[model samples]
Target: MAAVSLTAVPARADGPRPAVLVLPGGGYGHQADHEAEPVAEWLASLGIHAYVLRYRVAPHRHPAPLEDAKMAMLQIRSESSGPAVDPTRVGVLGFSAGGHLAATLSTAVATGNAALDVQAAVPDLTVLCYPVVSCTEDVHQGSVDNLLGASPSDDLLREVSADLHVTAATPPAFVWHTADDAAVPVHHSLAYTGSLIRAGVPAELHVFPHGRHGLGLATGDPGPDQWTSLCAAWLTRRGWTQSSPSVM
Candidate 1:
């Protein structure tokens, strides 16, 4: 079973608070540490309930990771889930391969399981950081191999290529990548953001000139660190955060 580590804030007297599920990148083989807890803490600092999902990785394959994400989303939105969060305000933030998973969840349809409410599993917003968005061009080979096996067919590749799945129903997104990201390439974000725009979903993309891939929060790095502030401001505009962007 996937484990969810919660970092919750006090319930607001106004109404249910917004919540976010953090998914760390590890190329679908493991979860990255830096992208997990610290990211959740930052969201919690903004007065939003945050949960870090350690979803299944390699040896699990395709639907397994996606299923775990869906289950986590459902758990977060459930009335009895222990937090006073607005079900309609749930979102996701993912990095690297985890960002691919987040995009998949945002664009995928329900699995036809009567027990799982599709609406509950879908995110209202999405944040992708240095994400792997394609299985074809500029593909992250390790992630593709782990999630779909070493020999994924063309049909399957298209199926998992997140940028190819965007629709009008896809959630609005905020995505950022370094222009020189050699690992996954900035084209991934460009393709996904373009698809979102074509689908009429609100989206934001930022390509930094420097910084290597997997710079979670880019803590000490001045240039890339601006993503946090920009994202916080985006969240505020979307009414997910009450804090001023400057504080981030």
Candidate 2:
């Protein structure tokens, strides 16, 4: 089973708070350290309960990581105590390969599994940072290889390619990437956002003029660091977080 660490805020007097499941990127080989706890704490600081999911990586293939993510979503929705999280307000935030996983969850349809509540596995909203959204063109080869093995079939690739799976039912998303990201490329984010627009799903996209791939919070750097503030405001507008006088 995957381990999930929680960073929860105190219960609000008004009602249950929104929560997010954070997934760190590592090309599906390992979870990135900077993207995990720090991101979770940031979400908590915004008055949202957050959980960092240490999902299974390489040596584990397709469905393993997805299954872990699904399980984590279910756990968050099922929690009745400890943290006052509203089950209906659950969302997901991921980076790189983790973003692929988050998008997968958002676009997934009912699996007809007897034990799993398919709807519960989907996020109410999604945030993808420097994500690997496609498995066909402009693909992150390492993430594709790690998640689906090196010789994944064309059909399997299409199945996991999130851009190809977007529907009107898919959750709204906020996506960001740098225009010059050599590793994953900005096309991944562009492709996904285009599909979202075509599907009539509310989507927001940001393409920074500069920055490399995997700039988790993009701290210190003046250019890409604005994504956090932008995302925070987006969350506030969506009612996921309280509107504050200033954003961190």
Backbone clashes per model, in order? 0, 0
lDDT of 1 by residue, 1-248 (tens): 34544444443435678889899999998889999988988888777888888888888888778888898888888857467888888999999999999998898734446555376799999999999999999888999999999788998899888899899999999999999988989999999999999999999999999989999999888789999999988999887876433211
Which residue pairs clash in candidate 2?
none
Scored against the true structure, residue 163 in model 1 reaches a CA lDDT of 92
For each candidate in the order shown, give its overall lDDT on alpha carbons: 0.86, 0.86
**Candidate 1 segments exceeding 4 Å error:** 1-14, 79-81, 109-117, 243-248
- Give the range where candidate 1 is weakest over 10 consecutive residues by summed lDDT: 4-13
lDDT of 2 by residue, 1-248 (tens): 34544444342435678889999999999889999989988888888888888888888888778877888898888987668788888999999999999988888833345455377899999999999989999878999989989799998899888899999999999999999999998999999999999999999999999998889999997789999999998998888776543223
Identify the candidate with maximal TM-score.
2
- Residue pairs that clash (backbone atoms under 3 angstroms), model 1: none
